[model samples]
Target: MQALFILSVWTSLVALGCLAPFVLALAYVWVDLFRPHDVAPALGQLFPFSLTTAVLTLGAYVLVDRRDPPRLGLLTALLIIWAGWITLTTTWALYPTAAWAKWDWAFKTILFSTLLPFFFRSRIQIEAALLVILCCIASNVVCFAIKSVLASGGYGRPLGLIQINAGWGGEGSTLGTYAFACLPLVAFLQRHSIVAPSRGWLRWVYFAAPVIAVIGAFGTFARAALVACVVWAALLWWRSRHKFMVAIMLVAGAAAVVPLMGDAWKARISTSFAPRQDESANTRLLVWEWTIGLANQYPAGAGFNGYLGNRFVTQDEWGEDNVQEGRAFHSIYFEVLGEHGWVGLAIFLATFAVFFLNMRSVRRAARARPELEWIGDLARALSHGVLIFMAGAAFVGIAFYPLHYYLLALAVSTSAALHRATLSSADRAPQESLADLAVGHNAARLPAWRQRAGQTKASI
Candidate 1:
């Protein structure tokens, strides 16, 4: 039910905004321009029957509104620097125009990353954005369950009676990654709830979300996610021996279920379940070996987004030992190494390294500082989940693809907000009502944020 409450509030607002088209689009223009994170006037809790809000948002993001900028970080700075080199290299490459085109395409992600911080200025913005994301995921689960229930004549099939829509990723690996991202948010929120818990239905949603998400991962049938969970357990054990012992017993019980898996399950699991026995794994190894030779040819390596270029589409052997008959190496790790080379891969991995160090440091600090235990836990889970996702995702997804992009952006937003919160207790401003702020957090010539915090009666 906790997931329900959080999901409801966020979705209800989104639904409301969607009801009115033109008017809200105008309002969002004002919202994004005056304050990127500001909400348009509310239409009660009812979802109106219009498609205006989303249309307006897309319009705003594209033609009208501009997002705020991000601060400097060693890893992030390197990303921008790499982007420049890629663009420059593309200009002189065999297919200069294609190079520039892809380079420009990649910039959308950079643009997305760079501007999020400026608009999410206040703590409320951070909290609301996160709530919106969690709610969206929860809402999807509820919808999927409803669809399954209706389809199954009430109880649904063991495989879930829900039919997959054309775009439903339903991949076990996809769901696993999504769950990994979401659980940290859920756990963090639960640990810090101002109105702790009493018996409530919403608590059911909270408990159920993690379960459904994990189960859905099995539905998606990506063995990588399952492998990730297993490895994750081992890491948790290494990090905390006591937790490891308890988890070991639980994992053993789960292992017993292997016999229950259907043939479809066995077929998918066979790939990673026994990599040496799998033909696909063997092929990937061949592809990876050839790709390594390509990376060695260019010391700085190919620029980001350089793989599968005009020539790659034609298999032009972009300096590799041999070009395979296949498209990409398929694996994310190889994809990054193949495209970005040693230099690009290093910059990319460096970001994960910082994330690892930050999480480890926060976990240590959390242990010593009881006062910050909740926050420290949130930070730890957020960082840990992200790190694991990237490591797993690198093999599963081309690093920094759409799925990775959104996840990383979420991390950057969370990390930046947490850091800001620590430095400026002034952010209690979010606790205030909108009427109190009178303007958005970005409104120029404002009084100190701490003073703004004094105006609102709201908490949590």
Candidate 2:
């Protein structure tokens, strides 16, 4: 009891530490997804801890100490606009209540994402942010691994687990998406460690973290996530300066995981090719077909939870007996289209396009400058993660997922910082050169004048 009391006291102190807000943000992301109430009921009960910390941090940022103005870019502007549009759509939505609920969630996500850029100013802070995310995912991996072990009696899951819980009553696919997004950050940390000798500890995490993440993704038996992993791995290999080494690592990793993938797992993934046989796949197709019909009929859109109301209406009018009930928009593109209309979808796509283009440019800029290479590597990883999400979105609904916007903010902020650094360096260069020239001129005159003085004295 004494030990427990002491431990509780220590925990409280840690929570109240100077860096508590950042830590709380990570904890919020984890608990929001994992819902580890059984593991730590105290923390679990404090479910709103993350949001509370975020609000507190924002207050601190504004009032506690005067800080520089936040670095806002195209992505930030677009995100705010996107949030406003989402709110506007709620008014015209088929179900205002449902739309309002979604709007509330989106508002929180956008607010948190917008606040992220302000927190990350230095490389260490950025890396720390990356670490926070990695740790959150790691918690999920550990939880899932334990569940798999218990379910399989330590032999391991033969077909992988189905619908691993990821807090807020979410499913394995959601966890898989989270893992997929984070993989690139893991790679970035690893690469950063190699480039910067100071972060030597990350090298170990680099090797271990990816394997765990892969396991976590596979455990979910999420085919889309697995596909994303393949794409990511390929991209990583292509970007690697050491192709041979990366290839060897990939081969070795595959060899290790192949034995663990039993026939059931193999068969499940193979269904990706023969999606018709899968009930889920068949339903998705029908949903998509229904979506197209609705899109044509209502070009303006249904507005927030519009699919539910529109689906019933469409069926009665179009009167298709074979059509399934209107389901959640499985695809992000389709979701935005259904809720916000073609105009919303266009803006959504445009936002992503602009954000990605900026990242690519940042990558090129970082690569060109040796000092900013870390930022470049980060850009590359973020862009790859975004691509994975883009493809993964077709399989699942995550249009308003916080991670997506957070990553965009990350990319934009990192790019802005790099440019600012470059400009600062450029500004200092001419001043430095002028100083050097003046010093040289003074030295030359001193020697000549000294010689003249000596000659004059000798002649006298």
Candidate 3:
């Protein structure tokens, strides 16, 4: 049934793409996020779903969609360089098989993200793209939340759609991080979304989404999610006009949710504060340390899956030497440093920095313009989402994930929209001023003309 439904949706969207090319773009994002093939193996055997969607999306863009090239800003440039650097590093990667496997999808993610701003130029297009992403993510989030509420989810449990506890969606920590990161976007969409209808019970679904995302994040029992929640709250409070009310609500919400958390969840989260006490946390610390040493030894980096070569020793609680080999970096920063080297890490950081600046630029440009307020608000939401993701990424190795790249693309699109709007307004300003001046000049002659007509009427 699931397979039939998914196929129906995919076919419908593909057909719709002929009339509206942006629909194809949305279809691609849907396939990427939902991974319908993974959900049903029978579907996978039929054809390559992801590759087909990508090809269709690109074809639609070239053949049907209007080509409005995005401004090649610092962010885009940085992303391009970053992509190139990672590819170059892959050539020297110690683990060639693993490196190439990662590079295949990673490069595609970068390329698509770079092209996203071009496809979504207008407010409606941009909002629709975000809505599609949120909905896809919510599918997993809703399921995870329901299971958590019913079973009181535990650490290492697979609460999402996929049973395997690996990759972005299946992994608890990464899923939890994504859940928190999406809160800001959810809030933005609820208020300003043009694509979503304002009337009916559908509107309330937006309200429920954030709550479900929170539950799902808690359900994962990930310390990274806890940290992301804190950062998300702080960013929300900072952006909110009613800081006091937001603070109160934050505190009250936390109070309400805390009691619902299981003992296992509390214990796992507590380990974050005292890293040495927990074996996992201790291992992460060791991995990060090893990454730093590796960075110094090989400044050029060991490329993707470089951690496979990592070997470290640690003393157990019993004071016995234990050897740990082939452990993952577990940190995005270390993952990049280990895989792509210092140069790639620099490019990665610069790209995000540029994204933040772009959002700031949009906010400042849209500040006083009431018509552009939605753009400003969206920019804030994207920035907050990015900030939360960055906080989460400190603990999770998601440097090359599609989520962050999507957020970055949205930021760029918002900034680009702001610039185009500003320029159009500027072009109209002179014409409007001249029309006002001509109206005033005509009004100034009207009284004398009326007096002359009155004198002529009296003489007649």
Question: What TM-score does candidate 1 reach?
Answer: 0.63
How far is 182's C-alpha from truth in model 1 (Å)? 3.1
Candidate with best lDDT: 3
Estimate, for each residue in 68-116, the C-alpha lDDT of model 2 and write its tens digit.
Answer: 4446777888888887777777787788888888888777787677767
lDDT of each: 0.50, 0.67, 0.86
lDDT per residue for candidate 1 within 130-223, as digits (tens), equals: 4545654454444444443343211122232123321113333444555555666666666565433313876776667656655554444556
Q: Can you give the TM-score per candidate against the true fold?
A: 0.63, 0.82, 0.94
* Candidate 1 Cα misplacement greater than 4 A, ranges: 1-71, 85-105, 121-123, 135-172, 193-199, 235-245, 273-277, 303-324, 361-371, 403-460
Consecutive 10-residue window with the lowest summed lDDT within model 3: 194-203
Report the backbone clash tally of model 2.
2
Ranking by TM-score: 3, 2, 1
**Per-residue lDDT of 1-460 in model 3, one digit per residue for the tens?**
9889999999998998888888888888888888788767688789798899889888888877757667888888888888899999999998999999999999999989888887889989998899888878887778789999998887788777777787677787888889888888888878888778655887788777768878998898888888888998898888789999999999999999988896788888889889998878998998998898888887888889999987778788898988989999888999999998888788888888888888888888889999998999999899889889999889989888898898888888888888898889999999999998986677677888886776698799
